[model samples]
Target: MAAFARRKEQRLSRPDPSRKRALDARAAELVRLLNARERFCTASSCDGRVIVTDTDGTGIQKKNCTWLLVTHDPCVKDDVMTALEKATGDVVFKFEPFVLHVLCRELQDAQLLAVRSTHCLEVPLSHKGTLMVSEEYIEFLVHVANQKMEENIRRIDRFHKGLELALEAAVPADTLFPKGPEKSHSVYMHRRKRRTAQEQADPSRELEPQDDAESSLALFAEIML
Candidate 1:
């Protein structure tokens, strides 16, 4: 556990490999800012992108989904359309939830940091995320979305600052680990669809190409202590 914390600290002091592969200029900046914080270390992030797949192509076109324009940076409609020009078939602009995962010192620290970020610091985190706690480490998955890509990066920067400031201050007494909002009843009531025989036979055909987005978890809310 101590070693992990030390690693996070070291990461904060150095350049991140993620920055070099950032989808855009803005995403690289967010990666730099969030990883630079003392309270956390980023795991992954993505600036949503437009994908062009040529249906005529064969066998899981590895390079088929050409990134017309990928960026963690802010986006404008004109720029998006321009990138689409290169696309051949099944043009899909997937604005996935801007996601960021980070490791924290402890569960209590994650709770305290979350509360402050929501109420005091005002990070525009998605109304959903995961706070995975363990004796060795604590992880936070921040998910948010916006039509304009830049806004999400700005929010991430604010979230990082919020976590840093919260760590410096004393923990609040009222809600040490504030509860998240209850899940909608409808979510539980809904039944999953069964795959057809063809899908079962060729499961790989049904599988969508993996994107950078993380899998969804139980929804969460901005906590206030």
Candidate 2:
């Protein structure tokens, strides 16, 4: 129990090795940039990848998912495509969004960083995304998970703009810190704007309410009838 507590303390103190563990040049550059920020510590990230897998019924039990090539950058180059051609199975490129988890010193600090980091959904884009406040740490995740290459690039560009805005924003005097881990995994899901009862009603076909006096008179007339 004592050892576990000590490990937890060490984890909360700083980012783990995964933050700096980049598989390729692009991932390495992103890790470097995130680690350079004094107010931020990366939790996890991946550059992007193109995987080749064996789908044919030639392997053991006719099931195989062999990786011919796994790269950390965009697999758009001619040579990269050539490698795919040489693959023994189906060539698949699974475009992963650039994701970064950072610990912020305070709510204001997170707000500043969030505004700078481009996010996938509007929830993270807002200040509400900051979770698990502490005396010395707060957590903010930068995510842009798009499977489409063009959309992924666009979303990442937007996130980059958000980061720039945060850097240029004025800093707050007060700082907030994390106390305990806040479980908010649901924040990663894309939030849909729900239509209110009023919004759901067809405006063009809706019947206006009769005046109270008119309604009462109508009831009386019905009784007379």
Candidate 3:
């Protein structure tokens, strides 16, 4: 328990290492809220983005690609056109939805958040350059991507609210820290059994008031995607 607390503190204290070198504005509030809670801390997050990349035919590999343009908010055609002008190889346009990784204080805390997980969408607009699609088609693709961005924002909002409710109902951190190995094992088993019962009772049940925010920190970390 002490180790977990120490790790969380260290991670939260470290400077951001992402390309932007800071929390995305759209997800910053949610990330801050999670870190403020005793039971959870955000490891990493993206608030969703529209990107145009120049790749060496190996697809979306970061090391093999150059990011021509990236925007956290909806992008305009002029911006995309300007980016495409710099592409020397195969170009791809993409819309990646919001993603967040969180660390939980306990197994039960992970499971509780896991139950609220939602599906994420990644939309690819172009496989090659402007050769395969018309100007009108590109405009249409941008419209669709923008729509997806809107939905992504809605999911983030839902997730924020659902987490607020969950944190309020969560057991206090002091109570969760065990005094000994035996007590820790007992608590783990009890939580496991209760989680099993809950799942059996209603397999499809999700966080109340909204069902769109469906992704778990545990699952995201395990997948490492």
Query: Candidate 1 or 2, higher TM-score?
Result: 1
Model 2 residue 112 lDDT score: 40
Instruction: Determine the C-alpha RMSD for candidate 1 after optimal superposition of all C-alphas.
Output: 20.8
- List, in order, the clash count of every candidate structure: 2, 11, 4
The lDDT per prediction is: 0.40, 0.38, 0.69
Best by TM-score: 3
Q: What's model 2's overall lDDT? A: 0.38
Which regions in candidate 3 have their CA more than 4 angstroms from the true location? Answer: 115-130, 172-225
Off by over 4 Å in 2: 1-24, 27-30, 53-66, 73-93, 111-147, 154-157, 175-225
> What digit string (tens of lDDT, one per residue) describes model 1 on residues 1-225?
578778887765665565344334444655665456554566666544323122223334455444455544434445544544454544333444345556765454354434222211112111112212221221111112233334544555555455444333333222343444422121211211222343567777643322101111111223111
What is the TM-score of candidate 1? 0.41
Number of the top candidate by lDDT? 3
Q: Cα RMSD (Å) per model?
A: 20.8, 21.0, 6.0
lDDT of 2 by residue, 1-225 (tens): 355345435654664465244334444454555556555555556544434333443434236654444544434344334444455544333334455566654454454444223322211111112222231211111112223334545544545544544343332322221233332221111111111233356545442342222122123222211
User: Which residue window of length 10 is worst by lDDT in model 3?
Assistant: 210-219
Models sorted by TM-score, best on top: 3, 1, 2
